[model samples]
Target: MRAWSGQWRPGEGFGEPLPAWDGPSTLVLVFASPAVIADDTPPDPGGPLAGLLEAYPASVVMGCSTAGEILGGTIDDATVSVAVAQFASTRLRLLTGPIGGGTDSAAVGRDLAARLVAAEPDLAGVFVLSDGLRANGAQLAQGLSDGCAGTAVITGGLAGDGDRFDHTWVLVDGRPRTGMVSVLGLSGPHVRVGHGAGGGWSILGPERLVTRAEGNVVHELDGQPALTLYRSYLGDRMGDTAASTLMFPLSVRAPEGRQGAVVRTVQALDESAQSLVFTGDVPQGSIARLLRANTGELVDGAGEAVRRADLVPGLPTLALVVSCVGRRAVLGQRTEDELEMVMSRLPADVHLAGFYSYGEISPIGEHTSGLLNQTLTVTTIQETAA
Candidate 1:
């Protein structure tokens, strides 16, 4: 397998250089800003991305707009990061579909997973990218696992719309649209995939009970309005809901299960409902707490995830890092610290492509992959002869 990665800047124009290779690319992944390609400013099928699409017209193209582009060891804003994969021994099956606002996330995931498995039961792994805001990350993972039925490994992330928390886009084939989910399945006897996820935020105070909740919305905590409880901690920072609340995300864990805690960021404040919305589910009766990041530890956590992945020996054909936007929020200009740490642990020859997502997706320990916030998730892939 072979891979090529490059960045496209707005003012740079399409005339700028792009990834160049001899053979045909099997898959094309793009992560750009919403401004670059949205339903409103529909990209000309023959526009900036034309060169890439033309180069590999047969390639399964999948990608989404991101909060920021993860290019190698740097975190870039207002840029497009592209990666093209040309596989020799591995085969890829592309599954593109719509995800209705009220559609059952598990059903969508199950359908996608079932379709891929039916087509190729020996599927090595599946990578997914969905509408971050409209879809339930947890339900989708559950559905994917159910469909795969422990037959394949699944990993991916939810598309991000910067910090605006409004209007995210996903690119299927060469067209970009909202309310769509795309999956790329890698199968055959040669594909070898490995993944790891970790969060560095430390728990604050004592764990509280999630007294009431609906899906991803938390109505109350410890028998009180969730927002009211959150503000009690924010104090002066309460006014700026968008940025300030990100510093202290909710740490959640199932009450009875031995599963690890997953941190969730406050997506929005529902004044009328008097609740807090998160990227994924916050089950009622679960244990919850506020988490604050220790910058140094956060960087260490990124490294830890890379070390844990134990990627295939030699060099990975592709390395994709899906990290949380909250990590970028806490790290600010220093956000590169996490990316740098993750990159340092990989072989220099591996093709790197990543993005800061609204929410990450990956399994933790014995658990199946799930939607996660404020965590760094790494996926590495390679192919060897059967």
Candidate 2:
């Protein structure tokens, strides 16, 4: 496989022209800043993607808006990051569908998975990008995992609108749109895919039982208003729940006979209802603990994730790093440290491309895929000789 990656700014086109490839590209992943995607003003509202489409017109183009864009070892905001891959023995297919609302997320995932499996019976792996704000990430991941039934590895993340949590967009066929989910299916014996996730967050305070909850919305914890209990932990920083909560996400343990404990970050707060809406589900009767992490722990976690991915050494590989927007908010100026750590841990010939997302989708154990937040998720792809 041959890969090329570069960044594009508003006024500064792509820093340089795409390197000429001997063969047609197989997949093009485009991660753009929300600012570039939301600028639907007049001429060229399509932003930098127009150039990308013209460059890889035949490739399966897919990606989403991000809290921050990542290319190679560098991280930047308000810019577009593009990665084009030409695989020798891999076959690719793209599937997309509308997500009417949060409740429709699971169904949409199942449908997408069914279509992809039917189209490619030997489906090797599936990477997904979904509407971050409007879709229930937990349900979507579950549906995809169940639908695939251990046939393929599933990895990807939700689109992000930076820290706004207001609007997010997904790119399908080089067009950015809202309330949609896109799946990229990879198949062929030579296509190798590996994924790993890590979060070095420490639990704070005592664990509380989720007394009342519905899907991703938690109304009460240990019989206390969920938002109120969470505010106690935030204290003075409770003013901006959406942004502040990123610093302290929740560690939720699902009910018995289900996926194990996973991280959940606040997506919104209902002041009137005294509830907290998380990026993933916090099931009623489950245990919830607040989590906090220092810079060292977070950076180490990134390296640990790469170690977990276990990519083969000395192979041309593409590593897609989907980190949480919360991690970016907490890392601040040191955000690049995690990205640099990822690059250092990966193979020397690696092409790194990804974004900070609203919610990260990765497998927790074996074939059990789960939606994660405030965690670093890595998906590596390489094609061996046919």
Candidate 3:
């Protein structure tokens, strides 16, 4: 596989000229800042995206807006980071569908998986990008897993609108759009995909029982108003519920004979109803506890994720690092430390491109995939033989 990556800014444009590939690329992944996606100005005919599509008409171009873009070992907020890869003897397919509402997220995911699997019986892996605020990430991940039927490994993340949580966009073949989900299917025996996820957060305070909940919203915990109990923990920071809650995400563990514990970050807050909206599901009867972490632990978690990915040495690989936006917020000025740690642990020839997302999607076990929050997830793609 051959790969190339570059960054483009508003006035400066791309840092360097586009590469001259031998032929059309198999995949072109574009991670742009929310500013770029929210721009209302007319599209420039000679812009970077247009130039890319014109150059590789046969390629599958897909990505989404991010809280922050990751390129190489650097992290930037207002730039567009792109990675183009050309694979040998690996087949690719792209599928997209509308996520009408949060309630319909599961169905959309199941339908997309079914279509991809039906078209490519040997589908080896899938990378998904969906509207962060509009879809229930937990349900979407579960639906995709059910539809795949243990035939493929799935990984990716939900689109982010920085900390605003107002709007998010996903790009399919053309321009960015809201209320959409896109998946890239990989097939063929030569394609080898490796994925790993880790979060270095420790539980704090006492565990509470989830008494009332609907989808991703927690109405009550331990028979008390969810927001009421959450505010008690925040104290002074309660003024900014959305941002403050990120510092202390919830650690939820399902009932017996179900998936393991997963983190959940606040997406919104209902002051009047005293409810808290999480990035993923917080099922009733699950045990929940607050979580906290430090910079060293978070950075170490990134290294652990790289270790879990088990990337082969001395191979041309593309490492897609999808980390939680909450981690970026917590890391503050030291955010790049995690990215640098990831780069240090990867193979010398690995090309890294990714973004800070609202929620992460990765397999937690051999046959189980789940939505994760406040964690770093790595997905590596390499061609073993061609």
Candidate 4:
């Protein structure tokens, strides 16, 4: 695989958007600030991106935004940083659109699946960058399964505004937008994708009941107000502050008969409303877990995930990472430490790129409900055959 990335100087960075990319490639674009793009107001209709894709002839280009960046050990927002990978033996395509809940979400998925199946590529799977605020995260997955009628894997995360979901954006031809989701379709016979999630939290109690909830807001648990339940979970240790709730996480066990328990970060707590604001929706009647992230544990888990993949014969030529922005909060100034820990396990020469997400999407041993949190999702693809 051939992978590389550099800045986009408006003056010198001349090319078609699609052409910037190369063949059998998966391009990871870490889009810089929407604020920056809006203020500077450069000529971005078709963007250099089209030329990029035309240049590289990519299999897919998957990317999102970031509160921070880590490329070659240098992290900054000024970088229109990008990473590219070329799997010589692989063929791929990118599928994108916005799909809401109810019928819209299913429809979008079916349409995308139809196009994907029509291409009839080997179909490695689908990577998604979505609007967590609106899109039925699951419907897209289900639609792909039904429409495509295949067993390709789906992984990625909610394209969001760091931890603040109040305003999130997606990029289309160098433009930033809210309320839209992007999907990248990948096809290849030989590919490596690794994913892992641990809130650095050890499960607590025998598990508590989510007595009342709506979407991501938990009103009550164990018959008590959800706020009270949360307080009891961490005790006065929260130090009597409003934002203190940020330190604790909700470990939600999917309704009965499901195999995933996701760590949803607490974004806010309303005293008057007696409600808890979470990253993703928590349906009523869900079992709850109060969790924490140890700096070392977060980094260690990420390291282990990459190392586990490293055991494969050939080194990974490219890497795409989706780590929860919430974890970065827990890690403080040492947030980069976790990323570095993950990088430490990779070969220095293996090119890579990614973005921190509001919520991460990754398969848990091939499960249907695979979007998750406080974890790093690493996808690696290398040609195993000529």
Candidate 5:
């Protein structure tokens, strides 16, 4: 396998374009900050990506705007990270289609999953990137589980709009577009892929019973309005729930197996109904607990994610890091510390690429992949000797 990574600034131009490769190029991922994509100044994004696409026209290109981009070991803002790869023995296929705004998440996932199998029946794994603001990540993952039928490893995340969370873009065939889900399918006998998720947030206060909820919206918790309970915890920061509550996500333990509680960030507050909306589903009877994390714990969590992925000692052909934007919110100026910690555990030669997402998509236990928040999800890919 041959892989190359480069960084691009708004005016600095793309540092290095994808190198010319004779064989089939597997994939090209572009992670950029919102500022970079919205920049109107010189060296527009089109010119840089245009040149690369002309070179590797056959490569499947997909990505999204990020809170901060992970380019190798450095976490960058107001910049773009470009990673192109050519797998030695893996066959790659790309599928992308429209996802109706706030609706049809499961249908879209099922469609993508079916198309993936049709495209390559022996598909080994799948990576997804979708609109962060308008997609129901939990439903989409479930639909994928149903369609895949335990055949392929499903992983990826929802695109982020930085801290603003107003809008997000997903790259489909090198073009940035909204309300679209891009799925990349990897198939072949020699492709080795490993993934893991880690969120080192500590539970605060007792686990309150979710008294009333529907899908991802919780109307009440412990016999009180969900919003009221959330406000009680925030106190002075009640008015700024969008940004202030990122550090204090809800740790929800569903009314099922001992799979551990999955973290859920409060996406919005429905003041009229005194409800709280989350990025994923919060069953009516789930146990919801407040969660908090410090800078050190966040960084340590990233390292643990790296360890959990269990990558080979040397270097993988490509490594993608999908972390939650909430982690960035809490870390603030020290956000890069977490990325640095993850990089410290990887070999310098690994072609690393990723972004901060609204919700991470990876398996929480041994079976199905799930939509998670405040977690660092790592997926490493390499072509092992045939």
Candidate 6:
């Protein structure tokens, strides 16, 4: 794979990423955080992607707007940022459709799978990107997972807005929107892919059963207000509850499909109402776990991510990391140290790129990897010989 990057000032138009890419091999594009776009920008404008499409043209492109972007695993700023990589062995295919708020993900999945399967190429993995503005996150993630089969793996994230939930934009075809998802199906014998996550959460106390729920909103838990259980855990930090825990979500997976959880800050807490107001819907009868973070744990997790990126079993074309924003916060000022560890520990000289995700969608443990909750996650892409 080949890589390219560019930065634009605060009021710049969507333009090609610096160092135009011109190669016959297929292209797989990964992008960094997109800011609050200038006032004159169109609602669903191509934005920074205008330049990306111009360069790759037929190459399959997929990524999300982020709170911040890391090109080749480094941060870029207030201007647009781009990292383009070329893979000579893999075939890249792109797809997009309505996701969240009344959409058929099963159909969307099948359509994507059919296109990928027809190619019958040895699989590397599927890269998915989402607009993290709504509750349909899990639904859309499942749709893409179901759509592709016989694939090496799937990795990506729910785009973030620094800490603002309302500032997400999904890559639609080549455009950006609030209610869309973009996926790139990469299949080839030479493509190498591996993923892993850090370990530390010791399930504290018995699991809290979900007494009532909807989509991502939990009105009640164990027949009591959901917030009450949460507060019980918060103790002195109750004042910092929702805002502190907004990026963390209860993650679950059924034998049937993948699940993604991203909690918005609490909307309201009513004891008499026996309800909890949530920005996203949470189904009743789901489990809720108190998410916790320790400085040491977060840094160690970065090493785990690097281990996966380096162990992918082949020559890697590039490494794209999709980590939970919650992890960054937990580490605080020490976050840069984590970045340094990741950049240095991974196999030397691999082009690295990634973004802090609102919710990470990379695989780690075989059982519950796809939809990680409030944890650091990593994914690596490369090439392997037959």
Please, what is the whole-model Cα lDDT of each candidate in the order they appear? Answer: 0.81, 0.84, 0.85, 0.62, 0.80, 0.59
Score residue 1 of candidate 3 by CA lDDT.
82
Which candidate number maximizes lDDT? 3
Number of backbone collisions per candidate, in order? 0, 0, 0, 30, 0, 22
Over 1-386, each residue of candidate 1 has an lDDT whose tens digit, in order, gives 77778888776753446555434337788898876666435566645566567766666778888988987898787778888787886778888778867898899999999999999978989999988777888888878878888777788988888888788878876777778888888988888888888788777778899999988899999999988888887688666464668778888988876677788888788887889988789999999999877789889889888887777777546889999988888888779988889889988887888898888878743636678888999988887755
Give every collision pair in model 3.
none
* Superposed Cα deviation of residue 50, candidate 5 (Å): 1.1
- Evaluate model 1: give its TM-score: 0.91
Give the C-alpha miss distance for residue 35 in model 3, angstroms.
2.2
Candidate 6 or 2, higher TM-score: 2
Model 2 C-alpha lDDT per residue in residues 1-386, reported as the tens digit of each score: 88878899878888798865533437888898878876222215455877677666777888898988998778888898988888987888888888856357777888888888888889999999988878888889988988787889999999988877788888755668888889989998888889988888987899889999998899999999989988887798667557777778899886564666899878789999999988778889998899888998999898889998877777788899999888887888888998899888887778889999988999876677889988999999988887
Worst 10 residues of 3 by lDDT: 37-46
* Candidate order, lDDT descending: 3, 2, 1, 5, 4, 6
Q: Give the winner by TM-score.
A: 3
What would the per-residue lDDT of candidate 3 be over residues 226-311, giving only the tens digit for each residue?
99998887788666558777678899887663666899989789999999998788999999999888888888888888898877
> Candidate 5 on 1-386: residue-level lDDT in tens?
77778887776777554577734546778888877674222334366656666766766777788878888767778878888888877898888887756468888898889888877878889899888877888888877766777778889999877778777888765677878888888998777778877788887888799999999899999999999888887688557555668878899876675556789988888889989988789989888899888888888888988787766665456889999887877887887788788888877788788888889998765546779998998998877776
List residue ranges in candidate 1 displaced over 4 A. Answer: 11-25, 40-42, 233-242, 270-274, 365-367
Q: What is the TM-score of candidate 3?
A: 0.93
- TM-score for all predictions? 0.91, 0.92, 0.93, 0.82, 0.91, 0.80
Q: What is the lDDT of residue 250 in candidate 5?
A: 90
After superposing candidate 4 on the true structure, give the runs of residues whose Cα lies further than 4 Å from its correct spot. 6-30, 38-62, 72-74, 99-115, 136-150, 162-166, 173-175, 239-242, 255-257, 308-311
